[model samples]
Target: MAVISNSLQIKHGLSLWCPQSASINRTHRRSSIGLGRVLRRSYVAASSAFANENREFVIVGGGNAAGYAARTFVEHGMADGRLCIVSKEAYAPYERPALTKAYLFPLDKKPARLPGFHTCVGSGGERQTADWYKEKGIEMFYEDPVTSIDIEKQTLTTNSGKQLKYGSLIIATGCTASRFPEKIGGNLPGVHYIRDVADANLLVSSLERAWKVVIVGGGYIGMEVAAAAVGWKLDTTIIFPENHLLQRLFTPSLSRRYEELYQENGVKFLKGASIKNLEAGSDGRVTAVKLEDGSNIEADTVIIGIGAKPAVSPFESVGLNTSVGGIQVDGQFRTSIPGIFAVGDVAAFPLKMYDRIARVEHVDHARRSAQHCIKALLSAQTHTYDYLPYFYSRVFEYEGSPRKIWWQFFGDNVGETIEIGDFDPKIATFWIESGKLKGVLVESGSTEDFQLLPKLARSQPFVDKAKLQNASSVEEALDIARASLTS
Candidate 1:
């Protein structure tokens, strides 16, 4: 099996999320592994025996999209043993976000584990365990990832030499972490990345043995893991080239709020810093992180969370949205090639609300796009992917925290930002563009409170500038926006 260089290849069993400008604004997204030598060995032994098998529906990814699509298939009564899922991971699709959040909680907290966090559960549905797949008569090939495809023949081959001809295919292979090249010690022992459950498991072991921790790149992975590191009482420091955290989304004031919380919780920041290389100890474990400025920070564990890239290596015939780094798909998630639909983080579909083709690298989109694609496949009506771009996180949810920080955003962040709340019990930020509400971000809000934000973002309601200008509280602001909608 050939390798895709310079990325953390968990060979993601589906290794996915949705598209967000190739790297999900430098990764609220990532994971995927390349087919490896061991799998290739199995190909020789199994190729002849498993050759020329066929399935009516084949999902090439075992990530969020695959799991939700499987559920949809079951719902639509189409998964009658004719549907199959091929995954690189050993387990069925569980909630991938748990790998970043609860999976990293201190061992004493008894963090989340497989079977508990499986797909659909994250969004309040049935827990689809491996047994569920079997009971539903859904064929699953674990640790046997599809390695190559023949578009003309409508067949795909797996690493274990299973040949599968599909009447229709869904590409859900997600994305892989963008890492520092090995030339600079990116692959050092103490250095870690989180793209899959396997990657998180490795990082957990490293975190246990670690004291001083250095996290590179302050994207989703960086921020989330740093909180985990701080929770473990390790000396944690996050260094990034950006001036503040979540540069692509958070306004300075908003960033300051979260940064303050992290600092109060013992996470340090070294903003505007660039990485030179990682220095490893004699035992071949990383010991320190060196910056381009010739300064070095001593460390026991180093995690890289720069960004992610889509895993579309095997399907060259599928058209690509080169601008965003994904398989190009229409509103219905139909790819450039017929019968091969792409969803989850791998499909760059038209964002109807934004009137542009964009890829989302988030779980919500992965689940929604997959369901919509399956519905489109089964139905004759033309359907469009109308997704409200959203991103969110909650850090330090474990016990003994000064405060637990959580936030959720809806719609685009491309405009002027207005903020409310003081980041004590809560905070809300709104972005208005072209005299309409374009985006909303809220921290620590109730379910009912959150319901309004997505609506405001979607409707793009005209603003009452003076009313908003005088608004002092989130409720006041909400009322103002509500009145604007009615007006």
Candidate 2:
């Protein structure tokens, strides 16, 4: 049986992984291992067999989590022919968030774009280049997908019939967008879903000739696309089945505020409505979308952003446990089968911070969890992962501001929200909960707010609710929070 650690970090800076009693028992058992020499030798033989079969740690994805893990493993003296990354995509890992803004903007004043597989400077400024990975001695197998995993033999077969063995495996395969139901005419040419850079490129190509674009689902992706379309002076309509935008995330009041912001930017919204069927023109392009209420809206293009389903089919036949469409892992990122681990959007683990089962899709969560997994791989022991949830998005102006600002955090359970800068039309709201700062949402605040909020959220014991609400500035809020924690 695999040993699992039960630990939770509480007050003070110290981390508690296992109980003191349990540690003492483990130590005592190690000292009395004279009678278990035969069992120990057998275990050593099995481990040695695994080590000889595959000298390198094989990672089965090329995303942020996989890149970070590869770096972390190498940095910790695990290098020397001991690490390889296999990514199905042709390009190396690159940031996906900026594809809508920086990549699509004009040359002279474009935002910072993500680095691609090859270093080609577009209109945007210089980002981190992919060649840096090769410089660091990392081996990458691009466009190679592992089709099957032989768990007992610790071997993997790729789509190209290349077979490789591994002592340990890390699955970082992320999710894909949920497809429209088959009966609703989803196979239409002009209907598309955004999941990767390729999808974004296709949408941009379609937008060139699209007179009107209809987006299904009012989540962040849909809203961000709507904002971009409105910025480009395109006819954009957002159809949401929910009555309010971002209903699943924020309060109705906040959703209304966002609705007003979008409306001011000339983006039309269709609330409490669902698409019944899509109609294609004679040219084999989408011409209109028929609503469940029997109403039809003209459209040249339709983008589906309804959300994602876990990319877990590759691991399903291997008998890996999963919950809610993601692979299940323990605190140490270890799957049900030993020597195999998983992380990022694909791993469903119990969240110590939220006190619930969670599968986070944010960059910060992926990085932190990957770090913990690397630490576990090194020590060969269970390590508890504890990190605060963080997320952000770029939205339209608060009032009539021409500048673009960011909204960092939004959640109802978080206590009073404090705002800074011009709160009139442009505003920044910081959510505080239980005398601790939880998150911040910026509409027209400085980019510095994004850099500082995540750190403040992690270092707990936030400010008092009353003090935070009445604070004059961010500096004052920080001071008050510090004082409250110490007091």
Candidate 3:
């Protein structure tokens, strides 16, 4: 490799490095090029470009977690000076959840846009935009991914050949969507995965002419995309290896409810089946799907929402402690390497409430954990992160019956029995273990229900079946349940 020093300007910041000059001394400071005398000068005072390259806080990845952490740093008066966010994406952090929801809608549907769904806003806070970053003196290295990191050296090198040294580092690289192997026709055209805005845009663009669409893996992404497909008046078919949709999380009864609704909306389901290979047309686009059982189904478009894997390639040589899912972190979001922290879907942290390690892949966890990590770094607080796991989904218009469902759930669902509430306009399911509440799931609940149900679930109050059965409302039921625990 050729060795040369050149001044490379970092976007939205200062020069990433000192200019190549023989006059520069070992300290990278300026020295007079003369045989008679030598004068020394600081790089910051000599070069305007050199002052911008170094960062006090360097965060990898520009997703929700990184965005929130930056916002937290700013909120706590760390806004100016050396804060740099290196991201592979061209744009800064936005609402990634929108990629599957409103973003896939038709043009007339008025979908979400940048600066609208920015970080902190997703958590009901202020929107931090490019202008905000410029005003706050934060540097963003967009479209330039950090290719290597050396914890011992306290530095990282980006793909653009720019080296950034950090006093503190935060790893929030997030996750990547898993695609089928190329040998199995995954490389064929008309196949897509929705992980970023570009992916969503491609899928949405294809929907204009795609009438028959086959969706593989019936997880949340698949189910949500299926809803969007149905709205587009396409013939949608969802295939998965599981017996029911979200089989790992939703109970059979709840799964049936969602499955029935989808079926009623003209969506086809192929459960307990696996894709053998994709059949392609002469144009090198997927034309049909072949099942392992030797069955074939015609398809104009294919979507694989199998799952996501943490983007941890850069850390392979770094030797940070990582689990199969993500980087293993303590309650405070600190990884095995001190001064280096991990958050969001890329972090597998110990769940204090459950006393088990959990790597949650959800928006709520991402936002909270990012803040937690920053708070710990700032205050040096030793408080364990006690966060309640929460997840939700939004689906609208099923079978033209004006179907709309907004559901939220808290805690683990494993239990000996379940208590079901009225399943009409509102549905609630409580998981009970040893006569104590372990989890709560409520759909279309009243304001009071959202406010109290989680507290009740967290407290794990003992339940009185007679009182709970007689209670008419969620609040009333919770009150009666709490009384039993206290009494």
lDDT values for all models: 0.79, 0.63, 0.73
Which candidate achieves the best TM-score against the true structure? 1
lDDT of 3 at 260: 86
Per-residue alpha-carbon lDDT of model 2 for 1-487, expressed as tens digits?
Answer: 0001111111112121211101101221111313322111011223443455453577888766776676677668775466778888777765555555444442334434445422212213233245656666667788888888876666778888777676677888876677887577676888887766677777777776678989888876787777766655678899989889765455466677778777887789999997899998898778998999999989988888777766776787533333334677666676655567788878766667655556666655666777688777775555477656656676442333364646665322356656553444455466666656666555544555456655556655546677767877655655565565456
| After superposition, candidate 1 runs with Cα above 4 Å error | 1-52
Worst 10 residues of 3 by lDDT: 1-10
* Rank list by lDDT: 1, 3, 2
| Candidate 1 structure quality by residue, lDDT tens digits, 220-251 | 78888888888799999999999898877788
State the TM-score for model 3.
Answer: 0.86
By TM-score, the better pick of 1 and 3 is: 1
What's the residue-level lDDT of 69 in candidate 2?
77
In model 3, where do residues sit more than 4 Å from their true spots? 1-52, 317-324, 397-401, 419-422, 465-487
The Cα RMSD in angstroms, rounded to one decimal, for candidate 3 relative to the true structure is: 11.3
For model 2, state the Cα shift of residue 450 in Å: 4.5
Which of 2 and 3 is the better model by lDDT?
3
